[model samples]
Target: MKQLFISIFFLMNFVCCFAQEINDKEIDSLYKEDQFYAGVTYNLLGKMPKDVSQSGFSLGFHLGFIKDMPINKNRNIAIGLGLGYSANSFNQNLLINKDNTGSTIYSVLKDSNTFTKNKFSSHLIELPIEFRWRTSTATDYNFWRIYMGFKLGYVFAHTTKYRGDLGKLRFSNIEDFNNFQYGITLSAGYNTWNIFLYYALNPIFSGDASLDGNKIDMNAVKIGLMFYIL
Candidate 1:
């Protein structure tokens, strides 16, 4: 997945550069700022179910294109709408299995601690809308920027993988996982590198998933660095 993002990054970059060479000069009053981006994040599970604990590092990769429309005369303030892709993984102690009837079983992973891996992953198609502010000029190559946004994504693919004492087990397209997720995001910093944060507004799992007659509820939190390419 990481390799996929890297390929997208380079491909988008080449396209952008080629487009610029075809029309290298722009009217300062109508110029746009960075419009391509890629990021890496440390994924965290919030509001975890009782006894649930993360067992390994969780990571995420993202890449996208944004259409920047300046909102003010200075061309320093803008609104951006974008489409992006993200892949994320969360490693935890929550055990998921299926009964003979193919009904999913949920539990706090039990003894032997024999399991070597237990993780769930999601791949999303995302839409992001942002209000942006920056201290920049049409000719400037570096500047400070702040972007506040709302993002919504559709989980088109998902899976769980485990290996260890129980041998190998895998689950795909879990019906209990929420198909849509929404979040609030913030990204700010200097040229090239920026700090990015996202917090989900809804749980990742549906009520059909439970651990003690109560539903399992949890959301995602991500913190990372983002790189923008003009």
Candidate 2:
């Protein structure tokens, strides 16, 4: 993690210097038209069950194209619509299982399991809409931006995997997993580096999904960096 932070810091500096080296004419041609959006985030599970805990790093990535429409004369403010594919993995200790009746259940694995890895992963096709504000001119390549948006996603796949004393096992197409998800997102920063956050408004699983007899109400929370390319 320390090395990751160091690399990011230097990368941002390099971008700043590179942007400065470019002339206004070139910068204008590059940034005047909004192009693609791509980003990665560190996932954090919020309001998780008391017995469940994260065991390692969780991460997510998105790739998409953005269509930006200027809402102001200066084009500094605009609204954007993006279509994207996103995937996420949550590395944790929770054991996802199915009872004899085939109901999905979430439980904690015993320490004796000596697990090497345990995780849940999902992929989605998503549409994101954003209201964007930026301190940018047609001739400027480096600028500050604030983007707030909401995203709707449909799950295409879901899986769980565990490698431990009992041996490696995987469960695909988990039952009762939510097929649709919606969330609010915010990204704010300067130049190529932006702070990104996402909060899911819906549970990860259907309301009827449970652990033992209790409802599973976990939602995903993600925070990290976002980078945009034009």
Candidate 3:
């Protein structure tokens, strides 16, 4: 995590320097614009135990509105503030259980009666902020862009599910899951298609949540495509 942050810091610096080298007059001629963004991503668990593994595809999707505010006289460089909603699911072998003491515990399910399908899902309201650069003109719709940002999310709903010969079981509004999440995001590409990456800065579960008496400090990583509309 420390190394990741260090790399991001240097990347941001490089982008800023590159932006400064562009022609000021040309940048000034571009118009500032607001946009709507929607995306679908594949989610992966990061920093998880080797014994705990994903069983199937983990998916996520989000939609949002962004208000762009230009920093320089040239509209090519701007800061964007957005409000969005996101939902994500992870299909894994870990089972979420409540112990006799009423504490949440994550355990690897492995037995004759072990679950055939297990998943954990979360829904969040998000606020995203980004520093953006684009090579665009008022008349041109196709452009290359690089956006680096962070998002703060509040989990409004969470669920855990299990299914097998023992029958299906589900628990909603799990109290042990972390209610707040934050992450760094990057998007870059040309025209209508963009590649997106997100790295969570916080764990998915609260510090008190444990797996085999060890804190389950797992973060989420997502990669996918994003589309923007003016």
List candidate 1 stretches off by more than 4 Å.
1-27, 110-112
TM for every model, in the order presented, reads: 0.88, 0.86, 0.83
After superposition, candidate 2 runs with Cα above 4 Å error:
2-34, 110-113
Better of 1 and 3 by TM-score: 1
lDDT tens string, model 2, 133-204? 998887766799999999999999999998888678789988678999899999899878789899999999
Q: Write the per-residue lDDT of candidate 1 for residues 1-230, one digit (tens) a residue.
A: 46546654764565457445524666465788768878888889999977888877788888899999999998899999999999999989888889999999887786537898999999999999999999988777579999999999999999999888888999999999999999999999987668999999999999898987888888999988777776
Strongest candidate by TM-score: 1
Per-residue lDDT for 151 in model 1? 94
Q: Per-prediction RMSD in angstroms?
A: 3.5, 3.5, 9.4
Q: In candidate 3, residue 150 scores what lDDT? A: 100
lDDT of each: 0.86, 0.80, 0.80
Per-residue lDDT, model 3, residue 204, is: 97
lDDT of 1 at 35: 85
lDDT for model 3: 0.80
Residue pairs in candidate 3 whose N, alpha carbon or C atoms collide under 3 angstroms: none
* Native-structure RMSD, model 3: 9.4
Q: Tell me the deviation in Å of residue 210 in model 1.
A: 0.8
